[model samples]
Target: MNTRTVDARGLEPPEPFERAMEAIADLAPGGEFILLLDRMPQPLLRMLDRDGYRHDARFREDGAVEIRIGRP
Candidate 1:
């Protein structure tokens, strides 16, 4: 499966979210999107849930987050 990655670590509010939204929009069917962040992206997770998108988030011991997002 093809995968697109967006590293949004250390970015302030809205930029990370915006970049994520853009990357998610451009994902092809059956493709996956990986997002790296410094903190948990609650809003993104919530939106994904509300929109019924397939996604999973993993939290590292170092306080980083990796989210894998897929098409609904």
Candidate 2:
């Protein structure tokens, strides 16, 4: 299936982070989501990992980051 991508550039860091978590929580067992963010807190990343979402995140040249999550 095509992955769902959420661009969080307009949201406040934590707000987007919270929204991402909410979206993940609402997904079915075999869901996939990708999030493009602009500087978020580390705690949020940790929380996401602990919840079983696989992620690939890094700082971008445009001051944004991308995180990918795929359920197994």
Query: Per-candidate RMSD vs. true structure?
Result: 1.3, 2.0
Distance from true location, Cα of 71 in model 2, Å: 2.4
Model 2 residue 14 CA deviation in Å: 3.3
As a whole number from 0 to 100, the lDDT of residue 34 in candidate 1 is: 89
List clashing residue pairs in candidate 1: none
The lDDT for every candidate, in the order shown, is: 0.87, 0.75
| Every model's TM-score | 0.88, 0.74
Clashes per candidate, residues 3 or more apart or on different chains: 0, 0
* Model 1 accuracy (lDDT, Cα): 0.87
For model 2 the local lDDT of residue 14 reads 71
Can you tell me which runs of candidate 2 are displaced by over 4 Å?
none
Candidate 2 residue pairs in clash (backbone atoms < 3 Å): none
Clashes of 1: 0
| Candidate 1, residue 9: lDDT | 94
Candidate 2 C-alpha lDDT tens digits along 2-70: 788888778865778777877787667778787887775577678767876666787778888877776
